[model samples]
Target: MLDPLRNQSVIFDFIEKEEYFAIHAPRQTGKTTLLHELAHRLNKEGNYISVVFS
Candidate 1:
């Protein structure tokens, strides 16, 4: 099973403010999911452009 920690607004807020941030953890630690959520939030903000890709 994949366990993902949710409600990471603090980290996402930092990124939304045009500040650089990083989330490092072991494999299967929800790194991609966190980034996905962050991107979604930023896009929804309507005041910034958020992009995530390989």
Candidate 2:
């Protein structure tokens, strides 16, 4: 679920700190959906500009 990404403290820390990072995972694991959702949320929060390059 979305919690899997939203609840990742390290990830939020990295994003909050503006640190460069990457998310690696196998195929069909909801990576894209997660990213889009994250971007939407982040944008809605009016903090960062999140985009998915694919």
**Winning candidate number (lDDT):** 2
Off by over 4 Å in 2: 1-3, 6-9
Error of 2 at 15 (Å): 1.0
In angstroms, the error of model 2 at 36 is 0.3
Per-residue lDDT of model 1, residues 1-54, tens digit only: 223334466675675576777677888867898778767876897876878999
Q: What C-alpha lDDT do the candidate models reach, one value each?
A: 0.70, 0.72
Model 2 agreement with the true structure over 1-54: per-residue lDDT tens digits: 335555456667878887977877787777677777777778888977777787
Residue 43 in candidate 2, Cα distance off native in Å: 0.6
Q: Name the lDDT value of residue 1 in candidate 1.
A: 24
Superposed on all Cα atoms, model 1 deviates from the true structure by an RMSD in Å of 3.0
